[model samples]
Target chain A: MKIHENCEILSLYIDGRLDPSLKKEVDVHLLSCAECREITDRMKAAGKMLSSLEPLTAPPCLEKDVMDSLESRRSFSFIRMAPAAALFMLLVILVSYSLILPGKRNEKLTSGQNLLENEGTPPAVSGDGLPGAGSLKAPEGTSAKATTEEEERLVSGRNLMARIDNDDIKAELKDRPADRVPAASSAPALKVEEMKRCETEQGVREPEERVGMDAAGKKERPDTGASSTREKMGDMKVENRESEERMLPYISSPSKSKAALPEAEPALAGTKESGSPSPLVISNRKDFTMLWNLQNASGGLTCKLPDIDFNRQMVIAIPSNAGKTGYYIVDTVEKEDGIVVQYREMPIRDPAPTPYQIRVVNRKPGVELQKVE
Target chain B: MEKKALFEGIVREEKDKVFNLAYRLCGDFHQAHDITQETFMRAYGSFERFEGRSQLFTYLYRIACNVWKNSLRKKSFSSFTSYRLDDREIDPPAREPSPYESMRSEDRCRMVQKCLDSLPARERAIIVLRDIEGRTYEEIASILGCRLGTVKSRLARARKSLSEKVLPFMEVAGK
Candidate 1:
């Protein structure tokens, strides 16, 4: 093969890698060709200059930052962990609350979902005002024992009265105002934790020690024998149920003239205090998210929003008309629609027939007639 | 680049070998250490995408070579154009002193380092690995993953160009 000028055979020739005859051929060429000799001389000079090129020395502790970035400084901790803790705590609260103080929030959610699901569009069940959820129905083909029917109605009635209570709980939950603090934000917390880990790791410790401690922190924090997150979750659920009860419809009426009818008494409020939602048009999810945005709505509040299963006009019995009168019911179902709840207001305080209901009612004067439940 | 088997095999057999190569190449212990770490991290990061067709060491060495080149690029020493601007016009802003300079040779080395910095990372890398470091064409070809002919041409060109730039200051030992 004819050797090209840039052929690596020149390199091979220098390393003595060519075959003996080839080396001899190269050697003879080197003697005759001054141009070839110049090339060889330049090659050697280039090699010497490169080897003689100075080496850069690293400053001490330079490896620390790299190690820091690698070890505990990435978001793997929070992404893999914090939510798991929060979720675990939330589950624990639900399980424990189930055991300690029995409440029907789940049942209410299930039934509402059931109404949304199996009921195939049942008539509108409105719990405007009453202690027990006076979810009036044609029984919707649910052949529950009379007791179960009674229970569901009562529970739903409570949920409606407690509807404001849900808002109140939301108000309470938001009370912490932790939202303004960057550390409380989901992604920020992870970032903060990673930064802290980086600082801790890079601060003068041996690499092995830093790694060991990080591994230990991961194990200890997320999964040590102490699974308290679950218990915290359980407690949160209990608080949620309590808040749910607070929002239930209960009082007989606002004025004291008529005594509360015996039948409308919700078990929780022996002596009742009450509230209501306005009949204003809510345009969309924004309004609902706002409703969820409440004072006292704390302890990891989450909601499975009603798909607002049915939309029909039913007068919800106002057991305790304890809110500002201008407050009309705002339809958050199917977006916010301002609907007038036309009810005959015979201002009275005593409860009568059906105890409480959500429908047009005829009333005797001085006796506050509520939409019968 | 026979990416998987290359990675698996190299990761298993020559992590230290390549790391040593990087350490020697950069001439700074910690940077070398870091270059090794980053090289492996990159190798591992893209390990899943490796499709095996080339030798493992060759594949990893290619990655290492690219990585070192990148480091050069990051320092804004990408071309002779930038080199002239920084050297002739911009005084190197005040720098924190390093602890290791001990000899005139080192100071001379630092001066030459300025010249090396003037070259793009690709050229300097070719010269260092091929000429000074004395890597064989197959090994350099294997490391760089180029055709042997391309390696030869790059080696010759890299040496000729580096020689022209670095020759003025040094005392050459007459052979």
Candidate 2:
């Protein structure tokens, strides 16, 4: 801040060379000192004089001169830089698509084989035609993994998870057919009215009231052991593929009315009458439990149903087998009030996990899915 | 659609400021214009690297300063370009006409500029940018890649020296 120090910093001060702190000092000093003030004024005029000395313009041939110089050179063009980012994004998308989408051929083969092998009938769709042509929908049965190749593709896996749940019930029901026909498997040493009521509730025909009853009319014989149950199941004819496929559209649709629930009801009722306590028991070893939860404060669906329960449009699939897997879909809203269930138990293939994409459409109220106990 | 369109648009808009700054720093109309065109060409070549970090003007200013500085070097005009009258040449001609009334306004302006051309290249450059162009010290600092203090001090000395050379002429020109 002294005069000698101020003078050394002064020259730069006029030229904008002094730091702000030092410049502030000079500004304050120059305000009070006539000599330094005169010096500051003159320095400012000198700088201005130099700048206004010449007004410059680009020569007429400047662009031509530049272009002619540049004609022989290469690599400074604009197109070179833009393509890298675009190519990278495109590659990520193609890789994801390849990973996710499986061929139709494999899917059909899986469903076809499931029909041939899985013997357990699905949950009973009881209606007016008791045990007639009503088809069974096993919820949680997929045997597709025997042929599943590992990549990273996702199909409608939540539906597949629901089907797995139905299949578990089918496996349980198969081992204990009596569970399907509770009354016949139970003793019938009681009143006729009581027996008729039990039969009606179960959609079973009373053995005593039967006319034109052939094998369907045979009285229930209780079987305690697997061997005896096995004999009974062996004698019963397995429904052909055509019959199962023909009945699928009706039983699978959630929109079907309770009154018009597939006409195959009567025949299924007969199958139930003969089938014992869930002729199958789903063990925890082969038993895969799919726990699903999505982000909603008020309402959510847990796909732990006997069949694949697609009650809501946006569902999630957390296949323990396929860890952290999600399929992006703009789900169709529920067309009718009823729940839609599917039970295709031909070993369904677990989806490969390659093109697993999480495009978070961030909105004011974006839906979130997290793990729940 | 083509790359040239974007560059052309930039060139039309930014060429003047660039030319003026170059002219002020070099103190030669011919060299300043050349410097401006070369600055644009350099900018066009590296246009791909431009990621818009700062305003295009700031970038162009930095490029123009470098171009002017380099042209000074290429022409070996460093001694001439960087000379400060006090720091180097004081071509005093035995106390010229005492009235100081003989000089024209343009002669006074030229005399002041010729004296500024004597300062160090960077000091001369800073004076032209901050004092003459009335650029903010911060912008001058950024363009020259120096501290604000450097710009301030240099401008002060530059002004002081110019008036020493031209005040006699200014007093006359004003009368």
Candidate 3:
């Protein structure tokens, strides 16, 4: 065999692993080849040096360490419990995220022109409030059935009010100071003062021209019947319609009376043509009585709630649509035309019926709302 | 015997073998202790799956080698540092001067280990299992899970590499 090929067998020969036939050839070659012989001697010496390495006795405490670790592992099975711990963390994150998301959504609604954009829409209901009821004036039929359905909705809304106290609403309003209408100027008794404001603004109608006008019998004021009135009223209608496109009709509490009301009038008067069948405008006066103008055929109404004493507050539950109601807190602000009593809407949890009740509760500042069980 | 008892018996029987292999592989007693502990822990976790196809000690030695490799990877040695062997001394510096005989034995051992550490991990393991542990070729083949022919070729290469490293020192000492 060649010297290089014999060199390969030299290691196996040192390890005593070479077959007998190969060993004999390698042994005979080793005698003749100095290079191969030197390789064999070197491999053996290296193996002997490696063998001479002292075997280190494992530290005596090693057994204890290993055994204790195993014992403790029985108590805390990280491998077995890791998945459960991960699942628990995931649940906590989900619940916290869900709770935080709605508050953020509400805060977003009140930011910038969002407050102006959502004016006159149902306050707490999300995008496109009062679905299918767009731009349509309130029913001229205060039929017994409509009134009854309205009452049923009011009851449901009241139940919802009991569940969702004013705390969340207060938190939402904390940032919206400009949207509040100052109560000292515009606060008035509901039925009488709202009638006076209406009469003073329109000048065409007498306060004696009561509600309950049917579509056919509706009287068109002679001057308002002119095309100019129709054209101006149509423009106001279009503006109010556009503003309500993003409406969340949120109302602030009486406690927020010092805050300025957002400049978000739905142009109820401008949209009111004397002869049109508009939504029944219920102007809530200071004394808690309602004034309904059956002739105002606009999508929104304005109400002046009472100037609540610091110790007393009012909760006005109004059925907004089929599935939701708006809880309005009476915060009044005065304008050049008259006292514009504005209701800041509290977010309703569910939809309810109309004729939402006016409940005046004596509550001290920082006291919790009494839960109506 | 109950499985727990059987497992404990196996651990008692094989702990030294696994520890020795780990010590030779990493050349640090404390690190070898850690490696040995981890190997047995892994073996215990998978003890039920062990079918005894190979000797229990060989199976455990394989685990020790794997743990040692994983430890090296976690340290993230730069490729250059990994390739440049002899960075780790087999023994820590002596607290005091030792007798000449013991120091000589330690120097020889360190030289042998330095040469072993220079080889790639696979070849180093082959050298350790075959030469240092004195396992037969058949035993190493089963332990490494390679063919007998492969084991022989690898062993030959590893020995040849070690000789190149250590023979120079031996020749210098002889002179």
Candidate 4:
């Protein structure tokens, strides 16, 4: 074996790990090689020096320290989990708060929906045609007890509208002179004239002739009519026909003041010509909010109602077609003569009633309806 | 309670051997105490898994080797330099100056420990286990989790490295 190889094995040789034959070979090499002999002697001396180190005694406090650490670790496990518990509790509170907010919104929406459903009943209008004592006539097939409950809900809704209107009038009266303020008796008359202009611009046929034509058409195409009114008002203008189908005839409430009754006649006559209808013009925030909530609850096509300054802007709501489904306002074009509302009717799988379509317009005189195929 | 008592007895019996091994490996008295405590704590934690395949001290020596290796890694370079510096300040002086033989022995022990500390942790452990602790080659292999051939080769290299560091010191001391 080479001197280098012998040097490498020198440590193992001192530790007695080498075979007797290899040890004999190294022993023979060591006898002759001075470099290998010196290296082996030094390595043996180093081993002896390491072996002579005194064994150290362990400190007395070791066991106590370790036991204390283990005990503390066991006791504080709950403290380690505190953050996760806090985060879980926060998540639960957020979920419940989200759930409860929608529930309250749904309650307000439910009451508004009840008011809309009872629209078939004629409103007992006061002589001035403002929100009067609400007396609603139940539709056919509804029980009297259900009618009374519906009447009470409608009365509460009307009372809210009356309070809003009174507040608006008081604010208006404060801003204007007594002479410039329009008479309460002439308000319905102006509304009638506006309806007439709308009908003329839209080319709606007279209500009686359209009703006759609808009756004949229902006989020929039995499936075309989905309601009694649809069977009775075929090919009529949708706005006028649906208005007649859904709205109650405006009749004077049993009030002692007969002076304003005569002024409301022109409005009643216009209703007969155009078809019986509710007030389509929403002029206050309270009315718009109620309508907006009702629209959201009905789960139909939703419109983006612009933020309207009520003094300058109004919303004209086209009566919903209760007999047919899948009709929604596509857009509104404001023209010099009048505002033209364009609507689209798509075929739907389920034959559910269409929802009301409203347009935010400048508080102008007239609005015409147009259907887009 | 029985397991605790049994482990305490084991700690009592093995502490001196474990401490001596640690002292030779780290070349620091306080570090040896800490390493011994950590080894017994680890051994007690894993006592249920001991299975008694080899002797209990062999298992504990393996754990001590691992603990020492981990401490070497966790210690920063600056902290290691500081430990070397602190070694001079903390090492106890020989009590009896009149006894020249005892003083010479203590000086030789410090020189040998300083040379052992200069080697790599793995080589230092090998030298400490084989030369200082007097473990057999097979038992060293079991403690280090290496082959018998690897143990023999490593011990040879470790002893050679230790000789290189200690021989210069020995020459100075002789002069």
Candidate 5:
């Protein structure tokens, strides 16, 4: 290497970084070059002077200061996270509130549907109107204007009756079965005037009692003895009271009612009495499997078998009636001997054989069927 | 907690070497103190990134050099040019200087520091690490994040510049 190139190489040479061959080359070049030699000497002197300068001792408090700063920074970070933590909690609460509100609204809607289903008619025309009152012709001797007025009075009286509890009207009806006025008679004016009097005398009677009395009046119109009418009305009242009690628990607590609705649905669908045999109780999966296979072999069922835990529950399969299209479970009473399930039937326009009406109930040792007449 | 204890041990062990390196690089005791603190703070902040490929002191030395370089950039040229080291702020040596040798040694130290301060920051850092701090060429390369060849070339250039600035002082001391 030349003198100028050796200038850069001399730093490495002084630091002992050069190989023996290169170091020898730089040493050989240095002897012949005065300027490079002087440069190397000055560089060495500068390095020695720099090395002579003493290192400064750090302040005694530095470690303390650094740790304190780090500690403060850590605490400040936690404080900074406070708002985020609170925001997360707030988001959780809002999500839970939104989730719960929809469930309650759904329960209310289901309860409303159940009420409509059980009543079997639209809410506006349920109480004192005939089964198909909108299609019924006005009776003779009633002017169109008078018919409209009586209908209005009947509607008003129905509203008043709903406000009072059914228990009070049931008691009043029990005491005066002979004096009960028929609200579904051919004489529309007479029915309306009697309903108005009943409304004035004792608030109002339940529309169910009025409808029962009308059915009894129709059946016993030919007979002179009020005793027969009274017996029929008494049986009707007992059946109505039993049905009302069954429905009362559902209306009061919507959540449980929602769960129980599937079992109650088929029972609520019919109201007339049938002489069909008692329901077959299938308690275990083995019996259910056999029954299901038999049902499939016979032909498919009209409705799906309800899904239930066989350990906790059993299926009550009421036999299909050729004279009835649907079965309504009027009441289920658990006796020491067996469970007595009283049911009514819905008359079919065409009395064809129907599928077994299935009801899922808590597992009982034995069950008996009783027709509600 | 173990990591914190390890870091505290590092701070105790490496603080002086780092402070001395900063002191020679900037030629100001106060700025060196501040730079040393900043270096440790930055090291603690990014402690997780330290992969332990090198010694902890080498890593800390690299941070100190960076801290000094950044401080130089933030300062205006005029303020930097006008800046002077305050002798009162400098800590005394471990051993007391004799009355006779104190003035001459203090003057020589000041004059050498003044010459080091005149060089560019990169050159000054090279001279400080290799010459004053006595780090090997390979260590300087690792600390400065450069190739070994670059370290040699830069150190040559740095020593050359420092030699020119300190030549008059050396000549006067010789006389």
Candidate 6:
């Protein structure tokens, strides 16, 4: 580097500004170049003089004064921002809550309905009974579009049942037909076994027997009076309203079902006693009305079976002849272990009984009907 | 941490550097104190935005330079140079001095400060930052918000000018 060019390096070098390689280069250059040496010495002296200048001390009170001013300004700023922050937080909460509530309700409605389409049965109970109860729990086997009104009714009824004292419950259970108490004990397994039987029988049952087994079996059946099945159903509904108030207290737990199971067994064991071929058979559809004691007196058909206690009755009516139908229900019969309620495709309210459609609703949550395939 | 406590910590650590930069740039003790206060006040107002991209002292120095530059715009360089000769003789020799010796030292300091003030603002900033404040060229470039080459060239020009202006004083002292 020439004298003029080296002067830049000289100043940079004196200020420790040059890179090491350049500083060393300048150092070698300075040892030989008198003119560069003179310039470097002068630059060194000038840098020392300036760096030696005293640094000023800030006043002791300077920080306190500045901070006080800053605090006052910040308080004013916070006052301005407060309303906007509050409004933003409120909007976020409102938006989140609005978004969340319907999801919970829809979640309750949807979860179990899908299982009905897939499995054709009420969903099995999961741990939290409330959510599981909503699954496929519809009346008349129509899709589970149970109205909020029904939900509210179910909730209130459950609350009422919860209030029943244990003594009251036991007394109420005791008051039920002694034979029916064993049937209730046999309920869960009996339902499963009956459902399996019905599924098998559904394939083998002839069209004529499917219509009305009294016509096909040629067995005598007592005709239910008046052919006013609609009015009878209406009467049953009214009775259900009355009986549900009484039944709700006793039906909350499965302990009753387990207790009743052994008693129902002997009824099964005595199948030969009836000597009726299929001892559990209420195969004659006209005899179905005998299950509820709605048969005519003149017909001389006796409903001689011991009366049973149950939570609700399902009336399944299938069309048979024009404007005439057969009503079928789960018929409870004595069995070996206990009594069993058989759910078959029996017709009610119509004589033709074709297409084999059945409608059922058990208003009690705990006492769900076993789907016969 | 409370805003006051945070700001106080930064002030405690870098207050002298800020004050010295202000004093050196404007050559007025009162004005330097005022500028230092204003610099910290501005830093507090935007402290939330200070994302710590640079060192704290470097950031504070940038603010101090701007404050000093703004003060220069309001008052001319000649007025600042007039205040340069005072009781504050800038880290004078440690040995005790007679009145005449103190006066001579003050005169020399004033001469050096006058030479620094003669340079343009950009060059003056580089010289004060690099030569007086002993900041590296990279730091000088950062504080003045300029490229390293700009710091190098302007520093060279400021040094040339300073040497020319103070040469007569140095010669007189040499005799």
DockQ of each: 0.14, 0.24, 0.40, 0.39, 0.53, 0.31
For A62-159, candidate 3 gives per-residue lDDT tens digits of 77777777777776797689899999999999999778864543333233112222233232221222211111112221211123333333323312
**A1-373 in candidate 4: lDDT tens per residue?**
5545455588877767678998898888889888888889999988887776655555566566555544565456667888889999999999997787555544443343344343433332322221222111111212222233323323222111111122222221122111111112111211122233333444432343233323322222213222332222222223233222212111111011122222333323322232221224556675565455434434222334445677866665543321222333445566553444444433333222223344566654444444554
Residue range B79-150, candidate 5, lDDT tens digits: 433323435544445556786677677787789888988988887888889888898878988999889888
Candidate by candidate, in order, the iRMS in Å equals: 6.4, 7.5, 3.1, 2.8, 1.4, 3.3
Mind giving the per-residue lDDT tens digits that candidate 1 earns over A38-154? 666766766776676443333223334334444443466667888989999999998897786433443433333233223222222334222211332221222212244333333
Looking at candidate 3 chain A, the ten consecutive residues that score lowest on lDDT are A183-192
Candidate 4 residue runs with Cα over 4 Å from true position: A1-5, A31-35, A71-89, A96-373, B1-13, B33-55, B77-102, B145-147, B168-175
TM-score of each: 0.39, 0.36, 0.47, 0.51, 0.50, 0.41
lDDT of each: 0.39, 0.41, 0.47, 0.51, 0.54, 0.47
lDDT of 4 at B68: 84
* Candidate 3 residue lDDT tens string, B20-55: 888788766677777888888888888888888987
Better of 2 and 5 by TM-score: 5
Predicted complex 4: DockQ = 0.39
lDDT for residue A132 in candidate 1, whole number 0-100: 17
Q: Is candidate 1 or candidate 4 better by lDDT?
A: 4
* RMSD for each of the candidates: 21.9, 21.6, 17.6, 17.4, 18.7, 20.0
The residue pairs found clashing in candidate 4 are: A214-A234
Off by over 4 Å in 3: A1-5, A69-373, B1-8, B76-104, B145-147, B168-175
Task: Find the candidate with the highest lDDT and give its number.
Answer: 5
Q: Sort by TM-score, best first.
A: 4, 5, 3, 6, 1, 2
lDDT of 2 at A130: 15
lDDT of 2 at A152: 19
Number of backbone clashes in candidate 5:
1
